[model samples]
Target: MLTIRPATSADAQVAYDIRREAVRHHCIGAYPAEQMLAWTAGTAEDGYASLMASHFYMGCIEGEPVATGMLDVNAREIGAIFVLPGYMQQGLGKQMLAFLEALARNLGLAQVNLDATLNAAAFYRQCGYVGEATALYHSPRGIDLACVPMTKVLV
Candidate 1:
């Protein structure tokens, strides 16, 4: 069974670890090694500690966190939606997205946006997002990642 809950500081590292696993394992073939390494380089405890103030959700299966996502309310964007490698293709990501969209609707957001990873662009489209041209995002670690900008209207 999957349970979704607001993430606290105590769950920071757990969420970070799941993000790391999702990147290192699932994103390997889609992204070059160097890019993946740069993307995941700062997924440490302190980084996630700063995320505690944001609207983040941790998805757990029987009390173990296996997925994580964040909603940027002010920006009306979805950020860092990731499911652990072992938990992929099981509808967890979709469920997390639905949960976040519900929250966005409650917040009166008319639309939401995201820069989808190259591998995940199709999935976002399947979820009703319309994609724009691919763009190069300069990661915080100073790496350029190709991403597709997408948006979905909530209203």
Candidate 2:
């Protein structure tokens, strides 16, 4: 059985680990390898603390975090929707998205925005997100990466 639980302070490291793995290994984006190597998801000084500050969700099967994502109510955004490799094609991402969208609705956010990784554009499209714009985002160390901006209105 899959369990979607409220992320606690102890989960910060694990969530950060998942996010880092997705960015460095799984991502098929315009981000350069040089930039990817520098990604130290919240295990570092700056971003880890910030990540620890956000509201996050962890999807566990038998208590292992196989999928993770977050919703930032203050920013009206959904961030870091990722499923570990073995967990792919199992509808975990869609479940995470639906849960986050429901949270977004409850938070009074009319729309939720996220920067879709290049590989995930098709999936996000399948999930009913429309393109908002495209941009070159600077990853760690100012490495520029192509990102598709997308949004889904909750209304």
Candidate 3:
């Protein structure tokens, strides 16, 4: 069973590790080695601490965080949804997504958008996000990645 709760600043390192591991393991064939390296380059100082203290949530199983998700209420965007490699295909991603959508709905958001990575587009599609045209997502870390801009209507 997976339990999710708001993440604190102290969970920054764990979140960073999960993001790095998920990107490295699951995004292998979708992006080139150099691009992947650049995508996962920085430490949690790259805004994770603040993010955690804000809208971030960690999904844990037996008290071990195995997934991460964030909903930016102001921007109406879903970001940083990643599940550990070992936890993939177990419906954790879907659960986390549902949780985020619920949060959005409770906040009276009409819609939520996300720039889904190449490897994660299909997953987003399966979860009811609509959008297919690929776009170049300029990461805050100074890397441009091909991503599918997707949105889900909550209203």
Candidate 4:
């Protein structure tokens, strides 16, 4: 069973690890190796802790966190949705996304936006997100990643 809970500042490193692992394992063919390396090089201090204390959440199965997602309420954006490679193809990502979309609705948002990684665009599309043109997402950790700009209207 997957149980999701709000993450605290203490879970910063855990979130970071999950993101790194997911990107490294699942984003291989979508991005070049060097870009992926730069993207995942940073530690939790980069900003995971603050996000954890805000709207970050972890999805745990049998007490082990295997996925992460974040809802930027202020920006009306959904991001950081990642699942550990071992946990892929089990519908965890969809569950986490549905949870976040519900949260957006509760906040009175009519839509939510996200920058889907090249490898994840299809998945978001399958989840009912409409995609715009591909764009470069400049990561705070200093890497430019190709991403699809997507948005979903809550209905």
| C-alpha RMSD of each candidate structure in angstroms | 1.4, 2.4, 1.0, 0.8
Instruction: Rank the candidate models, highest lDDT first.
Output: 4, 3, 1, 2
Ten residues in a row with the worst lDDT in model 1? 41-50
Q: Model 3 Cα displacement at 21 (Å)?
A: 0.2
Q: Write the per-residue lDDT of candidate 4 for residues 32-71, one digit (tens) a residue.
A: 9998898888799986667887789999999899999999
Q: Which window of 10 residues has the lowest lDDT sum in candidate 2?
A: 40-49
Local error of candidate 2 at 27, Å?
1.4
lDDT of 1 by residue, 1-155 (tens): 78999999888888888888888987778888987887887655545667866999999999989999999999999987999998999999999999999999999999999999888998999999998699997765567899998999996
Question: Which runs of model 4 end up more than 4 angstroms from their true locations?
Answer: none
Q: What 10-residue stretch in candidate 4 is worst by lDDT?
A: 46-55
Off-target runs (Cα >4 Å) in candidate 3 are none
Give the Å error, residue 94, model 1. Answer: 0.1
Better of 2 and 3 by TM-score: 3
| Each model's lDDT | 0.88, 0.78, 0.92, 0.93
Q: List TM-score per model, in order.
A: 0.93, 0.85, 0.96, 0.97
* Candidate 2 per-residue lDDT over residues 18-96, each given as its tens digit: 7777666577454567656665434734455355567788899999998888898988878878787787889999999
> At residue 111, what lDDT does model 3 achieve?
93
Q: lDDT tens string, model 3, 86-113?
A: 9999999999999999999998998999
